[model samples]
Target: MFCSLVFCSLCFWHLLVFGNSDTVKTVSVSVTDGDTITLQNNDSQLQDNYLLSWTFERPESRIAEINKGARNFLIHDGVPDGRFRDRLKLDNQTGSLTIMNTRTTDSGLYEMTIKSKKDDTYRFTVAVYAYLIAPVISSDSSRCFSPLSPCSLVCSSVNLGHATLSWYKGISVLSSISVSDLSNTLSLPLEVEYQDKNTYSCVLNNPISNKTTHLNTTQFCHTCAVDSSEGHANCCDSVEAVLRLVVTALMGVAAATAMFF
Candidate 1:
């Protein structure tokens, strides 16, 4: 009887351990604001008597659920906050959850549980980023006057979410700047020769998306038109000519005074 009781206890322990064993998986999802994002459970066909549940941020707050046995579908969008009101969806056939018009506030951990003959759990870490605008390339007006000096260019954009502004020469990165705050203006400066021939571009990017603007050296960098007679294109040429004339005049006056003396 003692041996039998020990055997029964061991069997009970094994049942407790193996009976509740379920597959759990964690996935990362990233989406842009105002876009729809779906978290899949890989269950194409759910059992006739199945229970699927989803919770957001914390496990206590249930966001959505589907029960095939009860023939019911529920969305607890009003639990955590009204931020998810009317934006949550669930697929009864595949047991997938989709959020429409996702916002940055909706970014957090989402947990899904499916209970049937086989139990499975899925955890998703969702991140929603604001749409990124293309960086604008403009030449600094103060630095554009001198044709002999390096041309100063600025790449600017309105910061959206966590974004980085980068200047690239061909495929290699020349320099980069980033800001974590949103709606602020971000600018990165790059200096290049007026006659630069290498390809360069400015890019604004986040983890999931990027926008690029190519640098047009001729469009942004302006050199003074060459004088047809002088065959030179420089803003300082006229000043240099004036200085030469003044020196020559000074020399002539000195020579005349010496002759008179």
Candidate 2:
């Protein structure tokens, strides 16, 4: 009788260890660094027959447990571990997990399990993206005088991951440059009229970060003639605009001399 009891206990332990191994399923998750992330089941709703629980296996810890009945009780008072005690949130109704102010250390797979006729399980592969930095905008000219020239407003920055640099005129993007294979730095120059009246700016960005610098259009074409059709086009032809202004002035002086003679 003693041997039979020991054999039965051994069988029960083996079932607990290997019976539910196939129930662990994997899901994918991506979240911006320093942002809040929630892990939940999208397909199934909580029903009367099953109970819900969550486990974060990468940290080797039990995250949460919930009972489904009217007298629903939260095991471990809803906090299952020390690392997540301050920032973890458990939904009383759906048993979803929410992590606030997430960091790189928090990136890992999370699992949600339900005890029903068949044990249902879901896994999530969580990833936290790095934050981005703003770029600096520089000018490649000592002074932009009446003689219009092709001056470049250079925008550049160094950071991890991917980034894009762009030049804008008002609300519209004049041009954009992108770099993905680069480990940390990007730079681009947007050539434009070297006058104060032609407003422009440079912007830098990544998936999680954005930065911008505005051009002092007033410093570019300090003196400009308004073109009725294109707003500022007649004022922006670098060398041509200056040549036209000089020729027009000289012609006016010559005409005045002839009238006096």
Q: Among these predicted structures, which one has the highest lDDT?
A: 1
* lDDT, candidate 1, 76-165, per-residue tens: 888697889998777778777778888888889998888888887777777888788899999755333344567778999985788999
| Location of the lowest summed lDDT over 10 successive residues in candidate 1 | 1-10
* Model 1 Cα shift for residue 22 (angstroms): 2.2
With a 3 Å backbone cut-off (N, CA, C), the pairs that clash in candidate 1 are none
Alpha-carbon runs more than 4 Å astray in model 1: 1-20, 225-261
* TM-scores vs. true structure, each candidate: 0.74, 0.48
lDDT of each: 0.78, 0.63
Residue-level error in angstroms, candidate 2, position 64: 6.2
Q: Which regions of candidate 2 fall more than 4 Å away from where they truly are? A: 1-31, 42-93, 104-109, 123-134, 140-148, 158-160, 169-175, 179-183, 195-198, 207-211, 218-261
Q: What is the TM-score (0 to 1) of candidate 1?
A: 0.74
Could you give the C-alpha RMSD of every candidate to the true structure, in order shown?
Answer: 11.2, 13.8
